[model samples]
Target: MRNMRLAAALALVFILVTTVFLGGCGQKLAVAPQQGGLQGLKKLKVGLVFDVGGRGDKSFNDAAYEGLEKAEKEFGDKIEIKYLEPSAGGENRERLLRLMAQDKYDLIFGVGFIFTDSIAKVAKEFPQIKFGLIDGFVPGLKAENNISCLLFREHEGSFLVGAAAAMQSKTGKIGFVGGMQSPLIEKFETGYIAGAKYINPNIGILSDYIGTASDAFKDPVKGKELTLKQIKDGADVIYHASGASGIGVLEAAASQQKFVIGVDSDQSLPAKEDQRSFVLTSMLKRVDVAVYETIRSLVTQKFQGGYQEFGVQENGVGYAENQYNKELIAANKAKLDELKEKIIMGEIKVPTSKEDLK
Candidate 1:
């Protein structure tokens, strides 16, 4: 009886530990179910932490999710992947990143520029692990082939859509809605302005922002309000880099029957069907491509540290010409391609900052 009781206690302890690790304790880890397991094979473990607006933002974060999904699809047999979403404001981003590093994930990804500092800290602590930072990095900080800064030439892509907006706008007055007030966001804003002015030097462009914080990307109500104000002020076209908040810009466009451009992703698909017609071309930043390439490099043992840029020349950025806005793009495709060639060939330089625009 004593022997049997001891065995039962051990079994119970094992069960409890298993349950907690498998998330029976109420925290669900979206771990991909393994198939055809190699009993002795070592699988690369990967973790990704989302930026503000999380997975369903249908903008930047969603694009990152696509890259994760692609990596899983391509390397499911060789790798295991999991992701976590931060609280609404992303206040605990560093905490979450550090927790993942503490768990010893082999490869981790920080989905936005907000993760620059957090990933830098965690990457340094876990020198053996590789970290991929999207759109952010620690300047001059090297982690011995551990940190890969995945930067994008977002300004070039934004310029394409900005020029498209100028060519198609009926009122000759377009607008821009940015998520936050940062040099990064200014990349989109200044690029858009320069692109528009490149085509129509005398054009009028109205620019507004959702807020001054990360939460700015989550506020669609404010996006709609600002968009409406721009519309009322006689702007006939709008483009937004406000992440989830861009949904409001879409709504405002639908209500007012005005055309709007989208950012990050090919957002025309997610727009309300009725509102889809009014969506102009989108500036495609290829965040999904960047994410996928990072994962691929790691899995293929080609991973290296330092900065990597995704720009038009790299096919890492461009404009979306889809069925929803094929007509507009078709009309401007010639000029758009010309300007794109110029940027790629060094004939026309796109401004990445406001000061450079002059």
Candidate 2:
């Protein structure tokens, strides 16, 4: 981590990447409606930096963008917005954040856990500026009072979908695919296994990860390969916490007409018509709500530093029940909600780590 920081510092000197702007309301990640001019009709100035896969991932990044879009509509001409995506390998996150600080944006947002180190470093230098971090955390970030660590109880939502997968599986076996194989994604895996076991104590679960690095989220080809392997192993239903990579999982499952669960956003909503039927349900992580509320807090002068957590109790995480998956989910909805209530009531403990799952 220290080596990366040194490299980033040097990049800011000999190889800077912070000046790439595309010209728009939110030039970095989006184009907001023009309020006459960038200087005219501005209230709060906001900036956002997307994670590696950028805006079209239709998963984590897309969910965060939804919140930014909502804030733009409600705030109207009263707010100014700008967003940026990192370099191809996501190596310039710190520089982009530092540039935003230099630009004096009122509130800056780093939209994934990958930004924890970058945001924490930058927020300290610009102590007066506020930052919102989705799915990121730092040891002393709370005390800084300039950065909001927006966290989600991802395991809670994952558990619900896991239960759904177990209940719907006819093969008595299921599978889980994760992106980047980190402790964060482990929450998805652990909760999934727990929920599946809760439904059937002896149910077999086959799991795999796209990779150990950030590229894992973008590797759809590898995602498909892993999904197919799981299916061949007798696992009928599958769930994925992968970002864009899960698109391959969805496609692979549909090829065999097996059930699959999605994460972050509703995969079925944007899925191709032919592949849409295979997506059983998605674990709604509610990244949009978190982003919108953080923005709202700033507007309402209620913004505070610390870990801002959202979970099942906060309605920040759950399972999706939409037109495509309504019938399938309805068959198991009653028990799923019962498990949800148990989670919220603290009656059933959902584990976030492999050790805890045991």
Per-candidate RMSD vs. true structure? 10.7, 16.6
Stretch of 10 with least lDDT, candidate 1: 28-37
lDDT of candidate 2 over 1-358, digit per residue (tens): 9999999898886543344432332473343344345644457888999988899998999999999999999986667788999987889999999999999899999988989999988988999999998888876655449989999999889889988988999999999999998999999999999899999999999999989988899888998999999999999999999898998999899999998899999889999999888899999999999989988988877899999899999999999988998988887999999999999899998888999887
Measured on C-alpha atoms, candidate 2 has an lDDT of 0.89
Candidate 1 global lDDT: 0.89
Window of ten residues with lowest summed lDDT in model 2: 16-25
List lDDT for all candidates, in order: 0.89, 0.89
TM-score for candidate 1 = 0.88
Off by over 4 Å in 2: 1-41
Q: Which lDDT tens digits does candidate 1 get at residues 1-358?
A: 9999999999999999998877753443232224333442678889999988999997999999999999999999778999999998899999988888888898899988988888888888889889999999678855356899999999999898889999988898999999987889999999999999999998999999988899999999999999999999989999999999999999998899999999899999887799889988788889899889988988888887889999999988899887778876787899999999999999988988988987
